[model samples]
Target: MALDPAPPMLEPPAGDEVARLRRMAQRQWAARRDLERRLHDGAALRVSALTLRLGLLSHLHPDEARDLRTAVEGIQDELHLVLQELRDIAGRLYPPLLDEAGLGPALREAAGRCAVPVRIDAPDERFGPDVEGAVYFAVLGCLSDGAATPVEVVIRRQADVLRVLVSGVDACDAGTIHDGVRLLGGTVALGESPAGDALITVRIPCV
Candidate 1:
């Protein structure tokens, strides 16, 4: 029998496909690494800076501390904001709470940070902490939809489960939102109701 012909070499991806993929991967990896850093190094840096600033302010003369105090005070404020932002970003990076705080409070906090009106309907008592972080990101995704449309977050407590309803936004990004939900073995379903903005619905298992 004739020897089998050698397999042809596959042509490499042309133009920017390779470059685009490389860039995309870089961005994703960088973002993941940054979040990990934030959760660890970022937290450490913020705490250290805040501690040092507070110690300095405690010893300064009122006159000196006045300007330094103001500056330090400003830094302190930014530090607090950064802490919150970092928590959100890092959680968005890799939620620390799904394994720590669960589904209810995390979502509530996400709702609180929104400029758009946010209504959080949570259980009278805490649900599984594993689920809260996922819920937090799910709500975050809904709010991020249009960035301009105000969003309402309704977290309903059902029999050992949680249902999330989001409305008043045109942009609905469910993949990211679902990833958050799935972090705790929860699932999400997306839809929109007319009249004005969009609506997104998510469901999760919480006990």
Candidate 2:
């Protein structure tokens, strides 16, 4: 019997391709940071100021027509909501906590907003911006997968490698997470826990 032709071997990315990917990632991060800053300093501030002014107007018109006072209060409430929404969008673009505190605290803040329970165990030590950003978003993406099960996340640094393991979240889009991590010279693996829950492992060089 004739032997089947050997399968082609997969080649690692060339040095130039890796460099290109890094450049793209850097540009993306920079853009996100810039957009966040604009939202924080520009739209959010303006809306907040307007809300305050409307409050003051409402007070000034207390003796005026009741409908006028009600209109001002309504506008103030809408503006307050707008300001909050702007802040939320800016945070989602690039969290200020991620830059100020580091990965552990940032993740904790994100977990607090999740519908299901989330447990995070990460060191307070800092890593490079790229490393921390990639890991933060990767974990966040998994948590946002809308799974009903509680999630457990653990992060550890060994020598130059940073390892993250997340369990109890299945149905996460592996391709999206893989692409984000791969851009930072990391690998992502999806498996099943002993109890059959989803397990995701990520490893990246922090140096």
Candidate 3:
């Protein structure tokens, strides 16, 4: 299949373009970080409190406590699940490992979470936070498209540009992927691989 044309480029003076892109990237990152903080500080805190309350159940009379203990334990188990889910959501918003470690480990963790097998070739290197975030999500958007398994991701720096290549499977929301890349002043190209699988190449100015 023929690939789609690139999205319309944003026209602005060099200084204006950089400033605009910087603001856009900062806004996107801030929104994600805010949501993650809310999840951790709100729901996660509440769940912890609930678990502490369950501990107080032991103060009741032995007969009453024994009778309710089983039920309370069940509830506690469910709350634990809720906490796990909250953390997962926070991680998805902005993976802590990404900051603690780097792009390679962060992408590897993301691939491990996928149900399908993914082969990755990302050097253990760090890029600007905005640049890394854009690249990570761009590849993630492709993975979440529910395409065929055994996807391959290759990341490298080409002079002043950071490149990410994703291959395997076919079919994705090209527009969504393009928008994410474009936010970081990057370009996204969609085409067919030699093996007939989908190929997505992303180039971002990292310098």
Candidate 4:
């Protein structure tokens, strides 16, 4: 089947969205740090409280004390899990290694989590934040499989220009990827190969 061109007037990225994303990213990072502090403090408090309870419960039947101990242990395990999950979310927000790893590693990590595999080929050089995020989501949009098909994403950089090509599964409107590419004042192209792969190309200036 032929892939239809993306909506001609695809929704542009709203200014509000850009501001909101920036604020949210900052808030989330702060919250993560605060949560880390709280976790450690809370754990300390819980241990103290549990110690008091253990003292009181020790006088009861041995079985009762054992049950109380088990419940306390369960609580500790749950808190630990919560703290770990929070850390993971914070770390992924703006990966620490983003500068060192460049866009390719981050894109690979994002694609790795997709239900369908996404193949990405990107430059080893680093790009600006807006350019990086644009490149990241340009490929990410395909992960939704809104058309119920798979996709392949290829990213390459030449001097100050970066190109992102996505093709596979159903052909999507150029409009579909255009807005995403436009975030960084880039251009996009959407097409499908004869063999049933949809393709999207995004070219952005790295300056």
Local distance difference test scores for all models: 0.62, 0.82, 0.79, 0.62
Top lDDT model: 2
**Model 2 quality (TM-score):** 0.83
Candidate 2 wrong stretches, greater than 4 Å? 1-13, 192-196
Candidate 2 local lDDT, 59-117, one digit each (tens): 77777768878898788888888878887887878888887899889999999999999
For residues 98-197, write the lDDT of model 1, one tens digit per residue.
3344455556666666777766666556553344444665666667554666566677878967787777754446677766655444566666666555
Error of 4 at 66 (Å): 3.5
Better of 1 and 4 by TM-score: 4
Q: Which 10-residue window in model 1 sums to the lowest lDDT?
A: 125-134
As a TM-score, model 3 comes out at: 0.79
Report lDDT (Cα) of residue 165, candidate 4: 74
Off by over 4 Å in 1: 1-109, 194-196
Q: After superposition, how far is residue 73 of candidate 3 from its true place, in Å?
A: 1.2
Residue 118 displacement in candidate 3 (angstroms): 0.4
- TM-scores for the candidates: 0.51, 0.83, 0.79, 0.58
**lDDT of candidate 4?**
0.62
**Candidate 3: residue 43 lDDT (0-100):** 83
- TM-score, cand. 1 vs. native: 0.51
**Candidate 3: count of backbone clashes, pairs at least 3 residues apart or interchain:** 0
Candidate 4 error regions (>4 Å)? 1-68, 84-92, 95-100, 146-150, 173-176, 194-196
Top candidate (TM-score): 2
Residue-level lDDT of model 3, residues 1-207, one tens digit each, is 999997777776687777788678978876786777788778899999998898777556467877688788898999999999888888878776775677788889888878889888987877866777777777788777776668988899989899888888455655666788786778878888888887888888876
Q: What shift in Å separates residue 133 of candidate 3 from its native position after superposition?
A: 2.2
